[model samples]
Target: MDPFADTLQRLREAFDSGCTRPAEFRAAQLKGLSRFLQENKQLLQEALAQDLHKATQLDSAFIRKEPFGLVLVIAPWNYPLNLSLEPLVGALAAGNCVVLKPSEVSKSTEKVLAKVLPRYLDQSCFAVVLGGPQETGQLLEHKFDYIFFTGSPRVGKIVMAAAAKHLTPVTLELGGKNPCYVDDNCDPQTVANRVAFFRYFNSGQTCVAPDYILCSPEMQARLLPALQSAITRFYGEDPQSSPDLGRIISEKNFQRLRGLLSCGHVAIGGQTDESDRYIAPTVLVGVQETEPVMQEEIFGPILPIMNVRSLDEAIEFIRRREKPLALYAFSNSSQVVKRVLAQTSSGGFCGNDGFMHMTVASLPFGGVGASGMGSYHGKFSFDTFSHHRACLLRRPGLEKVYALRYPPHTPRNLRVLLAAMETRSCSCALL
Candidate 1:
């Protein structure tokens, strides 16, 4: 079967059926998605490793109590399972039917998704479509009410441009060169501890992870040692052999990092064993502002630390670029935190923390400008998928009061109309 056509057809049928209107049906689908994930835990882990060398612990379920309407999900390979299943859980709870396009780079993961979703979901309602750019292009030719796309900004642009033909609203989860600032007031030890985790986790594949650290020359001198120590503590003396850390996603990603490191100075952990596709949790210091590593989104285990004169310099540096999916600031001072939050716009921000904002469903997650657009999580996700059909029902038999509004209006009629406008008031008082 043509996966895109068949899948879209089924979702259209389910949406038109009116089953999606019932809150009960939505809740049931949410349960099914979560149960399917739990039952097939091992399968998800295996497929992820084959696709990206990511650990199973990095994958987990998100909110499930809300429901949406009919949605098409385009997931990426970075965090394959969570990116695919988390939003699906929210969609079902919001009463949505779905057509999902799992990333073709991870062939095994796609098969696992196909195996599990049909088992737990209403088979006639939810469908998995598998293919690459051509299949995606074919699918986009059709009209969908909403699209939830997770990928790079370059492709996100094409998705959004195509969506415009149908006026289809979209949520684009895209990436950017995120900047992490270290203020003069920041504790060196605390800054090092937080930045190390944010820059290296998932082998630095996260969109919101700190792409590079902006610190003063004096601060970097103190911070460099602590960051190196933190990385060693988390991944052991040899990060290459540690099970806690994962490898870069693919060779293309590896070469990208290799080029960046070639252009910068290494302050700490500049080690790599390409034979096993392993790159150390290395930190690069003294990187030039014009360098390619600073110019692009560094999605790898490599961390490039650049020196800045002041917080103003850091803010100015970040301002010149596209709005990032996230802006991470580490400062105990209220003034610095307020200045960054108020002045800059990002999909989200974290104070004295990194990448933890995504876990909370209360805050709607998304990007702005070049970073991409729209947000969804938990109830927000449900709302994102379902369109609200507003109704303003009126009661009958209030003719006398409204009759005063008729033409040939006079003092008496005006008085009556004014009186009628007040549903509750002092009746006898000239009103």
Candidate 2:
């Protein structure tokens, strides 16, 4: 059978077989996932390194634990293991069936997961499907009780559209140009340091990574130097050798980033060695919105900084663009903070911080509009997969009380009915 038919049959059969509802069963599956991650940490970490230029273990370990307890994570290619397994841990804990779908582009990591999870958990209850477009296409054809997708917004739309056909609830953790605002009141050094770290992580191939920076002309002048110093402190002068920095994922990604650099003048670190797949951490200034890099997601080590006349200009710039998946403001002024928060619509906003908000685990991390739809993290993932079946059993004692309003047309009965139903709690809630 095809993956879709198999998965649907299995999930449906499992439900009908009374296999998924027991707390003990769910607890056991969750525990197995946690132990699986702890035991196989190094193997998975190494595979990500081989696939994507860098395999940052800290983020990997953080996301892995999510699925072990109570989440069903469907992670994407950019940060495969961290995104995929983290939410799975959360689902396992919540006692839900976990059916994961890893990206097809990264075949190596997919192979590793297909072998590992089944060895640790009961294959019947917790299973993962490894296939390409054909299988994934089929998997979606059947309605998942809940779905979590992290990718580009274009694909997010397709996922949501398909989900709507089944009336299946979904959470799409998608990407858009996440904005970073640098207000004049903020400490230039602190703000730039934070921005540079996140902007360059994974060579900027991240959903929450700040896509561009907005600032006043005066602060813009000061911010770049501070950002340079922070980059040096973190990665050192010889960034290629620095353990903190890593390479681009593949030749295609290297070319894609290299192509964007061609459209504008290189402000800093424009050098790249194609054979090495090393694009030096670069920064660009004086870039226009029409520039090739500005027109697309600069998901590379290249950081593009733009100057805005005032805070209002920055907000307007954002408003004109698609609603971003994540929005960030770095300001000490409470007024600016309130204004931006109230004026803007983003999937999530980090006040005086960058991507640290996603680490909270307690908060639902997902996007809105062009960024994506739905949300998953912690309890959000568990709820995403299971249907909330509300129950109301009618009691024998309430039958006569409700019957008078069914068919009577008398004025006396109408008056009596209005009096009886005047109580707030009397509406169908009593059943």
Could you say which candidate leads in TM-score? 1
Shift in Å, residue 6, candidate 2? 50
TM-scores for all predictions = 0.78, 0.77
**Candidate 2 regions off by >4 Å?**
1-73, 90-96, 419-431
Q: For model 1, how does the per-residue alpha-carbon lDDT over 381-400 read when each residue is reduced to its tens digit?
A: 76777666533333355555
Model 1 ranges off by over 4 Å: 1-69, 404-431
Q: Write the per-residue lDDT of candidate 2 for residues 266-305, one digit (tens) a residue.
A: 6667888998888888888888888888777777888788
lDDT, residue 290, model 1: 89
lDDT of 1: 0.81
Range of the 10 consecutive residues with the lowest summed lDDT in candidate 1? 55-64
Q: Measure candidate 1: CA RMSD.
A: 19.4
Q: lDDT of model 1 at residue 221?
A: 89
